[model samples]
Target: DRVQIINDGKFIFSDTIAGLNKQRQAFNLLCTLLAPPSVTSLQKISGVTAVETLSPSQFCLHYQPDLNPTAELLNLAVTQNWQLTELMPEQHSLEDVFMNIIQQEQESATVEQII
Candidate 1:
């Protein structure tokens, strides 16, 4: 089956389920630590695009799907002695995709207004 996503009356995405799944671009890593790692440090890593800190011990690491940094991230955690509690791919449901698209559009619009 196929699905399409529309935002602001504009067609944003059209693809099969598998294709949508392939669009996933992030992983969620939860750890038990005294302090969270530096977001700047993580973003400097190759393929890492963004780091969202859910809490001092939880982070959503966004990266290029093609150049996954999971291995490097895990290695850093081990070298730093972080007690990992959970590490999993970010499951993108249909709603999540739609929201992502909408949020991107909104952010771009805001940037445009500033420019």
Candidate 2:
């Protein structure tokens, strides 16, 4: 569980993601029903935001948030059905991107050295 607040410790939102899979079918159903409404609502909030399906069981939300995307995504998912997965807020900075590239290069170099 995580909490975000704004101004004088007024709570904005809280998020929780379960690490276990208990009701798998319901989870699947929620995902199917979730996309359309989520896309619509998020777009209405921000025109530049977009929802992309990475695979049958994976989705990626690209939003330039004036509001917290994780909180919004969690709200949307729960209203559709009970869900317990981390709604990742995935807007990376330039430094993060470069760090990731550097990490990958280091890992590959280590592997090459081992080989």
Model 1 global lDDT (CA atoms, 0 to 1): 0.72
| Candidate 1, pairs of clashing residues | none
lDDT of 2 by residue, 26-97 (tens): 111122332344445544533236666655445655555344355555666677663435454343453454
Give the runs in model 2 whose Cα sits over 4 Å from its true position.
1-48, 82-84, 91-96, 99-115
lDDT of each: 0.72, 0.45
Give the alpha carbon lDDT tens digit for every residue of 39-67 in model 1.
78777767788888878777777777677
Per-model RMSD to reference: 5.8, 15.3
Q: Residue 61 of model 1: what lDDT?
A: 76
Highest TM-score model number: 1
Worst 10 residues of 1 by lDDT: 25-34
Residue 36 lDDT in candidate 1: 49
Candidate 1's TM-score: 0.57
